[model samples]
Every structure is written in structure tokens, then in C-alpha cells.
Target: MSKEYNVAILGATGAVGTRMIQQLEQSTIPVKSLKLLASSRSAGKQLQFKGQPITVEEATPDSFAGIDLVLSSAGGSVSKKLLPEAVKRGAVCVDNTSAFRMEPDVPLVVPEVNEAALKNHHGIVANPNCSTIQMVVALEPIRKAFGLKQVIVSTYQAASGAGQSALNELKQEAQDYLDGKDIQDDAEILPTKGDKKHYPLAFNLLPQIDVFEDNGYTHEEWKMIHETKKIMLGDMNAKYIKVTATCVRVPVPIAHGETVYFTVDDPSVTVDQLREALKGAPGVVLQDNPAHQVYPQPLNAVGKRDTFVGRLRADEENPGSFNMWVVADNLLKGAAWNTVENAECLVKDNLI
Candidate 1:
């Protein structure tokens, strides 16, 4: 009989956390028990898993007793605080936050792109940022078929990427705009909640996703640039690969779309060759049929675990350069599903 392990879903009350529970149920990981964990206020709430209602419990440091795996999406600070504790109690954790992603010892992974990185995990595996996740998934196959040199991406991220509260605010703002109320009056969350200014996202696009760094790039952009490098190439080779990103938050409620321009080392690479590379790539769906006007869209990508790639075209001036549009359910493939997929990889590799 295959061994079944006890599992816990941290941040069980949040958007991505709840999706983690759903993904876990759909995953192949054999779970002996499922524990839902969240903050004190959210404790005692019942969340269904495989038709069974699991009561969410307060996440204390001691929550990981006898647990074999932990899927965490609880914000960076919460992961920073609880994951080490989970590790201490012998649970292998997959974190969906920026907390330990850049840590030298912690492996920042997108299973499709870098499942091998999981081998080096010191009990915690960091999931790549949501925007970074979808882009890398589409790029990996192309990079493998033709060596990658540079990547430039502009993302149209959804309001859901901010959190449940931001999604709520977006809906209210949209309704207020239709009702002739001031949409800007209650803007408190887009483009980074802690930033000095909040902008209405009802029908507007905010170029900034997170706080701007000294270099003028928002933290979201920084994450994509660095995380793409880290996942595509190891620390030694990461610096050699060039990556840059401009992240924008659109008013859409779910799924993120990105316009990615990439240069491959092989100058002779063609659009058809790129399509062939992505045709059967793991975790990717090729939707490029411009002749029929079919392409990946945010609405169609929702609730799906696959990253959709379309609009493939060669760059006019830059030889071996191509551009494509990629979309994925930010909450599913981006956060929750990726976290669960990491756990599945761990189990398959017997790391957990």
C-alpha cells in the first residue's frame, strides 16, 4: 500500500489558502489527515475538503505536530514566522509567499520549471510569485528547445492577486462607478496596500503592483525579474540571463495576462518552432491560432491549472526574438495549485 501522510493547509481562510485546499483534494497526494489552519479570528470556521468539513484551527507554532506536509499561502510575515516552526516539527513546507524565496538555502520553485530544486530544500520550498510563475512555465519549454538569453515581460495582473479584500474593493468600486459614486473615495488596496497612495482600479490600470524600490521597479517587478532568473538558471548562471518586468494591476477579478518578449540564443528559431516547443510542454496549453482569432484570455484561463500561451509572433527587428501572451488563473496555477504541485513533487521524490 502506498503510504499516506498527514497534511495541513496554512492560511486556510484566505483566497489562495482556500484554493490550496481545493487543489489538494484534486491532487494525487495521499492524505491521511487534513488540517485547516488560519488566524485566531478565523478559527472554528468550517471549510469543506472532499465533501468533509474540516474546522479551521488557529495556527500556532505547535500546529505542525505529526504533520508530514504543509501547503502555506498565509502572507510573507506569517510564513516567515510559522514555516520555520513547521520545519522544526518535521513537516515539509511549501510556501506561497516572498518570505523565504530569495533565501540561499530555500529553493524558490515552479515545479514544471525547476522540480530538481526541491532536492535542496531545508524543509521549506518557496513558490515563485504569481506573475513569475505563469511566465516561467511558458518560457521553460522554449528555453529548453532553444537556449534563453533575455526576457522582458509586462503583466496585466488581476485584482485577485492583491487578496480577498482587494477583490471585494474592486467589485464595490465597479458598482460605485456605475452608480455614479466616487470610485477613488474608498480606494485603499491596489498597487500595494501600504503605499502612500491608493488608486481606483474600477476601470483603471495601476502600473505599480507593489512598493517601488530605489531602482524605480516595483517589488512585484523585482520578484518576476529575479525569480525568473533563479528558476530558469541557478545562482551561478542566473546573473548571466537577463530578465526585466513591468507589473500592472488590471481591474479583472481573476487570472493574470502577460505580454512576454524573449530572445533565444539560437537566432534561427522561428515562430513555428516556438509553438512546437510549447505545444506539449508540461503545465502549458498552446492556444495560438491567430488565423481563427483564437487566443488565451483571462476569462477562459480562470480555475485552470494550465498556463495558456498564445499570440506567438517573431520580433520584427530582433532575430531569434519572439513575443507571446500568457495567461493563467493567478490563484490556481499561480499560487494554490503551484503550492500543491510542489507538495506532489515532494511526495513523488520521497522528500516529504
Candidate 2:
């Protein structure tokens, strides 16, 4: 007999939240009960799990009463307000927003990269940014083998990472464009909802994914830079790794693709050795066979949980530095699956 636990999803009606529900259907965790939670507007909505209809309830402090685990994707503000309450109610939370990720005490985890960090969680475990999650998943094995010194990544992010509205708008814009209508009017809630200006993501690439900081880096880019160091190299060794990222919103609907350039500590490490290391890395799939023109692509990665790596090569001019292409379903391994994987780790380690 398997041990069973009661689990709740904090943002049940949203994009990643829905994916969490779907992933749970296929999850290895033994769930005795599933509670769907969302804002009051989404309450009374019925969602299915294992062919059973589950009603989404309005999330509040009391919603966590009998819950053993909380997978939160209800946005940062919601997590900021409710996660502590969930913890107070004896529920461990795996937060998928930026709310508690940088909180020193909260463990920002990508189970493939930092499962050990879960042990340090007081009650909340943070799921990293979508782009950062997939990037680190592909880079962790390299970092572990050659000792990553610096990382520079440029991301072609899917509109799905923004929100369901953004994705819909992208489709709307494309259709409107093909119909000879004004595509500009279809733009509303992206590259971010908080930004004053909105851009059409259908036939255009917005260089910014979130509001820009004073330093000119968008919040999304900064999340990758800071979160990567935190997840890949914990506090003591964080300073050893230098990370920079440029996040862009592309027309793609589901998966995110990245071109990553990284420098390792050892210059002697060759391309063949790196390829072999990635081939055996857990949660990573190596698709780098240039002869056949095979490589990881966003279309191929959609719906998959593994990080796909390809285009592996050593930078001839910069010894110790290599470039690779990384792709994954932004909603799966990047968000929902990662959240579930963290919960699975906790259960496996008997932390729950």
C-alpha cells in the first residue's frame, strides 16, 4: 500500500494552475485527495482529475485546513498573502510565482538541479522563473562536471509564460493580421500586465518580458540572472558564478527556447566530453547530432517534462566557453511539472 497525502492547488483556474492539475493526474505522488483553489471569481468552477469532477473553491487562509501540500501559481501577490497562512495550517507550499523565490529562507528549487535545497525549506519551496528553470536544468550537469564560471543566455520565450490572456491575444493578433485588420488593437495584457505599454506578440518579438528596472534589465531577465545563481550555486558559492540574461517574448505559444553561452572553470574540457555528460544527465535529453540537422526545438518540446539540449559546440575563440540550445515546455518542466516535482521530492525524502 502506498502512503497517501492531501494536496491543493492554489491557482486552479489559471494557465499553469490548470497544467498542475493535469500533471497531477500523471504524477507519481500518492494523492488521497485533491483540492482545487482559485480566486472568488473562479470559485464554483468544476475541473476534472482522474475522471472525477472537482469544484474550485475560493482560496483563503482556511482553505488549507486539511491540506498536506500546496502547489501555488496564483500570482505573486496571492502567494505573498496566503503561503504563510498555509504554512501556519501545517501545509508545505511549492510556490510557482516570484513572490518568495528570492526570500533567503525559502528554497528556490529545480529538483533536477537542487533537490538538496528542499531540506532547508521552512515550509515554502519556490519554483523558479519559467525560463530559468529550463535553462538551469540543461546547464546543471555541465556546471556539475566543469564548474560553471559565467553564463549568458538570450531567451525566445513563449507567450504562454505571460498568461492565458497573453497567449490568446497572440493568436487573436495573428488572425487579425491575416484578415487585414489592425493587429495593434489586439494587444492588451503583455509583455506584462503591469506595464503601461502593450505590444503585439504575433508577428513581433518584444525585447522585454517584464517591466524594466533602473538598470535597464527587465524583471524577467533579472529573475533568470539572480535565480540561476541561487538555484545552481547556493549562498556560499553563488559569487563564483556570474549570470546574465535577456528575456524576449516571441510569437510561440507554448515552449521556450534559449541560446546559452557559458564558460566553465576548466579549459581542457572538450565538446565530446560535454556531449557525453549531457547524454547521461538526469531530466535532460541530448538531441545534438549536427550531421542529421537534429537539435532541440520549441515545437518538439511542447508537452514534454524533460529539458532538451542540442547545438552543443565549443567556442573556438573563447576556450572553456561553449554554446548550446535549450528548449522545454514553458508550462511543464518550467512551471507546473517543476512544482509537482518539488512536491514529489519532498514526499520521496519523507519531508511531507
Candidate 1 residue lDDT tens string, 1-352 = 9989999999999999989988999999999999999999999999999999999999999989999999998888999999999999999999998999889999999998999999999999999999999999999999898999998999999999999999999999999999999888879887788888989998999999989899999999889988888888867237767998999999999999999999999999999899889988999999999889999999999999999999999998999999999999999999999999999999999998
The lDDT of each candidate is 0.93, 0.92
The regions of model 1 sitting more than 4 angstroms off are: none
What is candidate 2's lDDT per residue for 8-122, written digit by digit as tens? Answer: 9999999999999999889989999999999999999999999999999999999999899999999999999999999999999999999998889999999989999999999
When summed lDDT is taken over every stretch of 10 residues in candidate 1, the lowest stretch is 232-241
| TM, every model | 0.98, 0.98
Error of 1 at 333 (Å): 0.7
Clashing pairs in 2: none
